[model samples]
Target: MQSPAHGRRLDAVTGPFTPRTPRVVAARRLHRRRDRDTAGRFLAEGPQAVREALDRTDTVVELFGTPTALDRHADLAARAARADLPVSEITDEALAALTETVAPQGLVAVCRHLDVPLRTALARGPRLVAVLAGIRDPGNAGTVLRTADAAGAGVVVFAGDTVDPYNGKCVRASAGSLFHVDVVRAADPGAAVAGLRAAGLTILATTGYGDSDLDDLVDHGRLAAPTAWLFGAEAHGLPEELTAVADARVRVPLHGRAESLNLAAAAAVCLYASARALR
Candidate 1:
């Protein structure tokens, strides 16, 4: 088992792990979100997430873990070593303070945020895409991203007012799929829909009261065209502007009187259905 007393010199490396101090703490918190957008940097924690980041080392800026984490995640540490990443040993207390969760997984990483241009995302040749509009829950946002990836979506776009994709909870909920998918934040919902249409992608918005039943509107044989699936926040369906721009408005047929599906579940159902339809 590795311990903080390992031969690695704590002061010799670059990235955020060089030395543990008040300054590093303050910098991490302040730059967590702002730097995410401007510098294209984000944070990842836990053994699994850190391992994933190490596999894609070009994306990692720094790696930190406690003695136990190093011992428990030897393979990850080996990868980090091969990547020449700055790896540092910190006290459990220090790791806990840097993380947002009550039980810190003893490992965390600073990574370059993925900047997938809207144009590039649209060009991915997706037969289906999922566009989330104003969904505020971080868990829902993450789950939707995971579902999109599972359904082989071309991309996942976040319209105005959606939760931050890098939020700790959202990142964890994504179970590392966040690293595999193209997720973009749009300036506005209307503009996003317009861009999709301009790319020759069909826009289909999901609504409980929609006139067209989803099953009837989607034809497996005719799914060759690029398509974007628009999902609304839980409290309200897609905004009026989005609904108005959609080429088609469709609904999932419900047998029970359940008011509506949770945003994440609905997204999964919609994405899976689209995948099946296209197959």
Candidate 2:
């Protein structure tokens, strides 16, 4: 329904929600990783993230946006309306307070954590998976998740001391792919590797130092089988113990003078290689 005030085409009326508003306060609490973990929810900003979060059933708990943001993205407003989700009109300052970005997207959605148990992800015979083993960068982790989805991977597991997939930067970096693929966070890297192997996935660790070369594996047509690619932080590759558990440690052959590829690029090359071989 259109607001009767000043012939505004918006559905919201009355006062815009502020940072101090109780519900807004609760949503704002998600800004911290600890509170988000405790509440089993995280914040997704921008119209794209909010729209994607809304697409999944029961994924979005509440959506808050500025009047201008809602006005600009009516399709999102309609989607929220169809879900019967409460769309609170929030002030700009409130939105900035809820986000880590200097330029707030003007829209934010409180979403249920997107991760599933590792077994659930490995079940159903996944042909391709990306395991972020001790990945410390949220941006890289998110980028790898996006690349995994694009490369036809069915799941992405965040293992060991990896950053939370729900980190604000990570969620934004995923570009909504967080909702597109199965995500797993395993605190124990060893058990995660074992589970992947038990599920019949060949665990390949991507590292600068490896006995096997990725090109050789592809050339030999060894990439057709179900595979899980393990990626680590760029500065320091996979931990020694984690690397030891891998079925094979494979390095992407650098034909160039450059010594190594960053985490995201390496993951894309490895995942796409398997995707092509599988097809």
Candidate 3:
């Protein structure tokens, strides 16, 4: 085991930092999520992702790594050094203790979370946006955000019962696009939809059994002004209330007998198609 001297906690010691008292562990978990809402703090892990976040945002608070990990990510270390970022060197075991994953990648970052207002994201006049309602899977949510970013959507809204965007898996899957796009967490679904409507954004719900096929209903060449594609959970689909408020319900044309597409896949197709239509 390797350890180093640091300002706060001892460098990674032999074991898992004495199990970090149950209360402390619980508090850190809460911090991961609440930090975003309350203090504008978020956690980014893994060398590549942390490096990306550090390069893009000025919100990084602390950078944690082991000697081997730092060697592998010399560029990031150099940047951190130049910025005077608080760096903590610990043993591999200690790094694992602070990480959410079973196999820690030996790097984790505490960064200031972005809380862009919905209106601010819409300011540039985005014609396509993705509104995720009640998406419970972190992987699914991350994929949706990634797709939205790729499709050039202005923002992604997580409305009601959705998985935390800061979840380690989601952050990893997003491939640092999470730093590039606007991600907003809504207090309620109805309010979010209402806000979009007020912004002159048309809400389109994606359903497996909609009467209008996405191919036919959406004229790629003549997309309507400011559109928001609404996707529901994979298992339950969108709630009836949400679907009811949509300006239109669209379904992807499927030639096969497959019941439905995965939520993330469906979101990507919808966002891409919508973006293509606008262009």
Candidate 4:
């Protein structure tokens, strides 16, 4: 098992890679987690993701595009060239292979993995952190990440059985916030929580039947300090064992007669509340 601190790249080694063909047979293999993990890379498709990935220095590995896509978004190729990154002109069939979208965006970029060790994120003295423990849905996880980034959370932890941070759906769902925030993929969520606590972050778990109310926490200024918010699986919510470790279990109040909000909605409410209070 890799420790949290092992997550550092020391220096971002921009690989001197050339996309021999726009098809990038190399990128096609990255659809699987094992392939992505082994290569230390993942795929980001669409103009938005490709654009954002390229905006960050040393993040994009190689870029692939159909002529139509390149022509439609000409600036992307220029950006890639300026960065001295490989740009491959591929066929529609190749774009089909590289992307999972029903309507392929005709653009794909190979990106270096963004996850760092929990220790690295903690060392930064992050005021807001979002922990996705036992979350298996990539879309939900990605949405939460987007929300976290919007709410000023500097770090996001994908712990235990959580979805891969590099999952294609997750990358698109993050809408480029994946590159904006520090990420931690912890095998042991308990250790992740312990490290956060050790770093002086108060852990608050979100559950439907929690003892504390979301508005009340903000009202009391309880969220003004460094804090880690733990969110659980979509179907089962947080486990008893995990929930027991929380300083508090918080629920969003339902004033509109809505039974509940989905994972993403609830997260947005909680994270924003904390964001507002911390300000």
Q: Highest lDDT, which number?
A: 2
Instruction: Please give the RMSD to the true structure for each candidate, in Å.
Output: 3.5, 2.6, 4.0, 8.2
Would you list the clashing residue pairs of candidate 2? Answer: none
Write down the worst ten-residue block by lDDT for model 4: 2-11
lDDT of 2 at 41: 96
Per-residue CA lDDT of candidate 3, range 105-202, in tens? 87777777664778787786767888889898888888888889999887888888888777777887788878878888886888889988888888
Q: How many residue pairs clash in each candidate?
A: 1, 0, 3, 0
lDDT of 4 at 137: 95
Per-residue accuracy of model 1 over 1-279 as CA lDDT, tens digit each: 223333222543432242356534743672356656665677788988887766663787777777678768767766676676667776666676667788878888878776487888877776788898988888888888889999998688888998778877888888887887878888688888888888888888889888778777655343446679999888888898888878778888887998888888778877887787777
Better of 1 and 4 by TM-score: 4
TM-score of predicted model 2?
A: 0.94
Tell me model 2's lDDT, rounded to 2 decimals.
0.86
lDDT of 4: 0.85
All candidates' TM-scores? 0.88, 0.94, 0.86, 0.89
lDDT of 1: 0.76
For candidate 2, give the lDDT of residue 112: 94
Candidate 1: residue pairs that collide: 40-113
Sort the predicted structures by lDDT, highest score first: 2, 4, 1, 3
Model 4: residue 196 alpha-carbon error in angstroms: 0.6
Q: Identify the superior model by TM-score, candidate 3 or candidate 4.
A: 4
Give me the displacement of residue 77 in model 3, in angstroms. Answer: 1.6
Higher-ranked by lDDT: 1 or 4: 4
